[model samples]
Target: MNIISENKSKKIEIEENKSKILDIKKEIEEKKIKIEDKKKELSKVKDMAKGEKEKMEEYKELKKQFKKIENEIYSTIAPLKREMRKLEKIVTDKKLKKQIQEYIEFPVKTFLNDSDLNVFRESIPNIEKIEKNPRKREKILRLIEYVLDGNLEDKKKEYMAYKEKVDSFVITSREENKEGIIKRKIDNLQSEIIKSEEKIKNLETKNDLLQKEILKSEEDIIEILEKDLDVKVQE
Candidate 1:
């Protein structure tokens, strides 16, 4: 073929490769959407299962109890952490300042880890000396008193008890119930998702190959324009 005709053919080849890549990408997106739909169907199936559904309700109740205690503890400690952040700026003692830093950074963990408010008790005298705002200092003292009074410790114990009960609870799925009778539905959806994923993978591999072909065609086009026609290609 003449150089001009050869160049035209290479340009067409690049466009064809790009068109094939776009088609493959469209197919991949469709497969992904199908996989998501299958997963949603699977979730609906599990929710319909009578035996597992009742069991999930029990598990949800236990979690509800645990969350109530968890919220109470954090709600009480949240203000303390804010107060500690204020103190962190003005505290003079290195050890007290660092402890306050830890409290501000990880309020729940530090508060639970410190037994009997030992760090606060040790720094109380220092805090009183440096705190300039009477209202803030009073609020800090009251919060410290709350921590030392064993109320938080009692709640902590309760939290741990509920936590263990929640964690130790088990969830098992059975296929024999009236709702669970269509376990095959779940199996079929899972199979569909797997097949859709495999198709996407194959499409991706094909697209990558097409990309290499497009690059080769473009390179050939550039060479023909620059060398055969003695043309100045912009790119």
Candidate 2:
């Protein structure tokens, strides 16, 4: 009876060990599947990072291309725009009939050549801001008109004043030139007078010497006459 009982116990112990081994195998299989799933997720993340890097590179290339295009546009168009603005001014100025006629020969060129387009574009924001507020727009327009009128009037006055100043300067310059010539003539005349005075002094000194020589000759003649008269009396 004791031997049979020990055999039965060994069989139950062996079954229990087999069951624990099967459980361990199942657990290891589940852990392996989880590890594989984590590897797949890591692969997807790596692919996503690569895709993002490619997208950024593409974006940088596109930005460089766009900047290059913008630079080309500016370089090509700036001078053309400046010409257009000058033509526009010529057309607006009433005195430029010849210029207007010349510009009419190339209307398309004139229109495209206006560099003021950039300035107009920049003003759009200010225009929109003003338009959004009616009171502000009216006030701004009124102020602009007032300033323009004031400036126009002031410009006329300033031009007249400038003309006067220029005329005055011209007159003053002419007067100064005349004064300079007159002074030069007076200096020449004064020099001539000094030369004449020097000549007169020279002549006076020569006349005094001549008069002294003549007086000495006359005295010598009188002494000779006296000696001759004395000799005649002794004879």
Candidate 3:
């Protein structure tokens, strides 16, 4: 009876060991599955971080371009602004003053061109009707003089002899303000410079946001590496 009991006990002990071994294998499989899931998560985080890094580089390049454009614009327009200020000091007519201010503000190439001259010439008849009123007459005459002065300078290079003589009267009567002609060109450049500066400011704001996004992405990547991978990030 003792010998039979010993054989049964040995059989039971062997079965218990087999069960423990199976349990350990199942636990190892579960851990392996968890590790694989974490690896996938870590890979996704790295991809996100890489995308953010690329965006940061792109933003930096864009910022450089914006800065370059801004500098070029300032260099081109600064001299023109100074010239406009100098011209402003010499002109006394309120109409001309307003025109100068408009030129500086708008700065378009086609402004105050031949078409504008033709329009002014056509309006002379209407202006003559207002001449009976001294206040209105004087204002109209000043406007005409300013327009004619500008037209004369613009046409001098294209028209000759008799036409030049006829056109010269417009500027000659006004004490020959050559600076007024230059003011028109300065205005156009100033407008371009202003536009470039606005673009730069907008790009600067975008770059700031991109930088913040990159920083956040890097932090997330570090957290994933440390928590999931159980590794320390060097930098």
Question: Who wins the TM-score comparison?
Answer: 1
Cα error, residue 152 of model 1, in Å, equals 0.9
| Backbone atom clashes (below 3 Å) for every candidate | 0, 4, 2
List TM-score per model, in order: 0.46, 0.35, 0.34
Residues 1-235, model 3: lDDT tens digits:
3434544554565555455555545555554565556556556555655665565565556555544544443343333333344445555667655655554564332232334543344335545443457776676556556656663343333333333444454444356443454344445445554554555555455555555555554565555545644533433
Candidate 3 — which residues are off by over 4 angstroms? 1-13, 84-235
Candidate 2 Cα misplacement greater than 4 A, ranges: 1-146, 149-159, 168-180
Candidate 1 to truth, TM: 0.46
RMSD in Å for all candidates? 20.6, 60.7, 25.9
Candidate 2 global Cα RMSD = 60.7
Tell me model 3's lDDT, rounded to 2 decimals: 0.49
Model 3 steric clash pairs: 107-187, 107-188
Cα deviation at 76, candidate 2, in Å, is: 34
Write the residue-wise lDDT of candidate 2 on 1-235 in tens digits.
Answer: 3434544554555555555555545555555565556556556555655665565565556555544544443443343333334344433345343433333454333323433333233223344343457776565445334433443344334434544555554555466454345455545545554554555556455545545554554555556657667988999
